[model samples]
Target: MAATASRSASPNTPGQQLFQALRRDTVGGALLLLAAAVALIWANSPASAEYFAIRDIELGYEPWHLRLSIGQWAADGLLAVFFFLVGIELKAEFTRGDLRRLRTAVVPIAAAAGGVLVPALICAAFLLTRPELLRGWAIPTATDIAFAVAVLAIVGSHLPKALRLFLLTLAAVDDLLAITIIAIFYTETIAVLPLAAALGVVIVYGLIASRFRRFFVDRAWAAWVVLLPLGLAAWALMHASGVHATIAGVLLGFTIPAVVGRASNRTTDADLGPSSQGGDGSGIDLAEALEHRIRPLSAGFAVPVFAFFAAGVDIGGSHGLAAAFTHPLTYGIMAALIVGKPVGILASTWLATRFTAGLDPSLRWADLTGVGLLAGIGFTVSLLVAELSFTAGSVEHDVAKVAVLSASLLSAAIAAFILTLRNAHHRRESQE
Candidate 1:
């Protein structure tokens, strides 16, 4: 969705756009959790063999290295759709939202860096002796934006705008870092010709998107008919190139024009409400339109399906559970998520605000502490990264998944507790 400028004269605020987006994400996040739970239960049940069989089913063309298991499809293909939404959101924020201003954006960006760095270091520390498990150091560095925001929507509705915006900005930057890590660190091998082909297709796609922006924006089905093939071709080429295919989604998302086609002055439908922006050729922008059309598929289907396929780690009965707990991978990820994340966020925020004089007096350190805890809820992205870090069906892979799930749950609980107390304090202060 298009984020309104913070300085806009319109009644619609950036907060409103974020709230609306988070509302949709909340529903998706709940569904994601439910799907994960089901997968976990099914994998551990009597019919666990069937679950593994379905996940291991391969159904792609053998040529071009496209033949992959069901789980691989969910991770490498469907998850790209989810990342596309992230790319759109990132572009929108930079182009139109609070992030448009460097002054407004620096705190969260710095905090996000700290959040990433500390967890990675903490994970490294725990896995120092176990070099094999160290690949998962990036697992806890991400924040599940949907799940964290959904928790805030439920528990921190009465809290100040500063806290909500802080969380949003931090999570957005966190996603960018995760994408960077996946693109840079995790890539194993590169096939030069296919990579070049993918880049060429993406460039052509960008030209087509920019040229036909108005046409595609006007005709909702045009993207599916024309753009989908181009996108699929790009994705296929990228997959062949041995880069994580999901990066293609981010690249494609960056190409979409943030504004509508040739609209000299665009007013969001959000700004004027339904009656004003619709019906006439001046309603929503192309970026917003794409978000609305694609988010349902991304959040509702892509994410949950990926979770269902990915989260079915067989933690190997009681013996496996005990071994996992003793494993460095498990301890590293848990420590990173539960401890390292908050410490990093808080320290970074403190340093930024201290040196820059940008702190809002009304917002206490406690408020940020709660937000930091929420940042620890690194579920969906963590699972994807874990799969990337270790071979599928390996012991390290299973332990890492279990660690991510456990750490996410623990982080969510801690965040809820902290924010609830903060919410009560804020309510009491307002009353007084």
Candidate 2:
């Protein structure tokens, strides 16, 4: 019985198990799915209006001398945390990941630039003709990393490891573009006093953190308690100052120490292979201490919370889907993420590698092209962009949500299909 059980054991493979766990657990992804399910059920239910009325419920606080609004406040306020984590990720990627140096960074950086610029152009070309939709230009410029990663992860053995990494790089680049546009173009008016106050607070935080060796000293924990409130104050200041509150996240994220993992053990050989006879220092240094402190917390809490709040959308199914795909704003977004991303990324990376970086001949153009298509799968940050594309409570805002959902899901599916087919073809050719 033991032998039979061992032979026929249906235990999930590690990757498969990880995939299932991630799918079930991602705070926003799970909630988005649940919310989507509820939306579908409600839309079909007799109480459809009741389901949508939830979108209108007053969740604001207007007590004492302060009279604050709710809907946009909740959406924007909650999403600021999302941007905060994004700020951390963008910095971490550039400081330590593939973008660490020129030699290792060519294909991904070029591809990312193409992915971002092409989508913006496509959105602009279509929407610029229509003044009403012009405000939503940033919608198409963003990509959702989870949906893209989820697509690749689901395809499993079909995708090459290199291709997966390529997609990740492109997604990172896509994020940078979306964040930049949000900070630079989408903001209202700059309120100076609050901006200055926010700057002052950031400086103070930096000083306190540096003086205390917050990254290394265990005693610094108590002082670190001040971070959230300070961050909140900064965000409020930014909000008051006319700059998008999201930029405050970027500013704060830079002050974070970049290293969390040891460079030596980052590889598989270090973890599973033999330990060295000699040691390299205490192994628990300041950089690792900082990363050890920040990464898990950021990954587990900050990121998922952001995803849940930012990703929720009311897809009306057939009608909703139709409106999302057909509307000018929707069409522009669809075209950019689907059509322009792959093409632009491929062209840019090829040009950079061939004429500039001079990559290895073995890294064929087809390989890069396949990877480029995979990068167009932008999900998380794109949804946030959709929220900003229109003023709160407007019909355009609702339409923008539908468009983000439709375009993200569609592009993710299409990119996966294309890449899987390409990978299959490449494997067959190699086998021959």
Candidate 3:
């Protein structure tokens, strides 16, 4: 009976199986860290020249301004895959998950807002004297969900499930805000024709996915054959539009329907994953299906590759290290990420609990604090913003990268310490 139940509980499809493995926070986080480490080591090694040579090698059609460096391809192309997964998750939360209800969603939403605003304000304050450096204010505002989840998985085993839910919802909202900032502030210019074409393609893509969700869901290869090309077209057009191609990924993700048919008796809990459990009745769930299929590719390959290309910053020497640390821009980002993120998140969460809903009964203030500090480990999107904020290879750019790296490390260590202690306390309480 046990073996039969175990087999019955397994993921139903190959895509679902792969998604289960890749979605493990540790797997994705380890790959990202490994890639970033390789890039950092290579950039500072004897073969540093070769590293930059490969990264700078460019190829693409010149007519559409698609030609770009290897690094640029990782940033502008592969990262779109990552953002696409993010979009699916965001839509799921809004449509069926915690964010669906005002009562359940207020805390994370308010906390995310505080997280973004406080960090930006703190960073901006530090860069006030140097107005030129203010463009990078958003650099410290992002929360790397993969990294935070990985850390939590390691140290938060005894923590309440509510804490994990809070973190995931908070990060989702944080990603949405980061996307908005990129679409608005980072886009310096736009080509109206390409932008319009991109939107049109996105609409068509949405229509196909919604209208023919069963078609794609029934045949696993259908999405790859049909929607993949359309998604790429939208991404390409959006790229040409100069609106940041990753935005195309999010827009495309938003179009997929979260719930397909009305609640039916046949749909099992396992079919819809954890989020769509009680309420949805499990119609096709195209959004969840597509997310599972593509997430492995995004988390396993695309994000790590982007990290490798983006994290290869060269510090000249001991002198350069000192200079980067002392530079106003670097320290400013460090302060904002390490200090502001926690203060803002904690303050906002407290205020929300006071007025709206209280913290989960199983949770304590310390757990929230640890999650806030963990959020300070901003890597993926932070690096992207750092890239966009300053010229490549410029002093400000390198300094900003260094600051993000340093601050993230410090934040992770501190959060780990606090959470480890909390985990112990919880374990002891359970035993008692």
Highest TM-score scorer = 3
In the range 165-242, model 2's lDDT, one tens digit per residue, is 666667756776777788788776776787899888777755654454432333335435766677777777777776
Q: Candidate 3: TM-score?
A: 0.92
What's the CA RMSD for each of the models? 5.6, 7.1, 3.4
Greater lDDT among 2 and 3 belongs to: 3
Which digits, one per residue and each the tens of the lDDT, describe model 3 over residues 267-328? 22343343322243346678877886677788889999999999999998799999998899
Please give the CA lDDT of all the candidate structures: 0.83, 0.59, 0.87
Q: How close is candidate 1 to the true structure, as a TM-score?
A: 0.88
Ranking by TM-score: 3, 1, 2
Which of candidates 1 and 3 reaches a greater lDDT? 3
Q: State TM-scores per candidate.
A: 0.88, 0.74, 0.92
Candidate 2 overall lDDT versus native: 0.59
Best by lDDT: 3
Pairs in clash, predicted candidate 1: none
At residue 255, give the lDDT of candidate 2. Answer: 62
List of clashing residue pairs for candidate 3: none
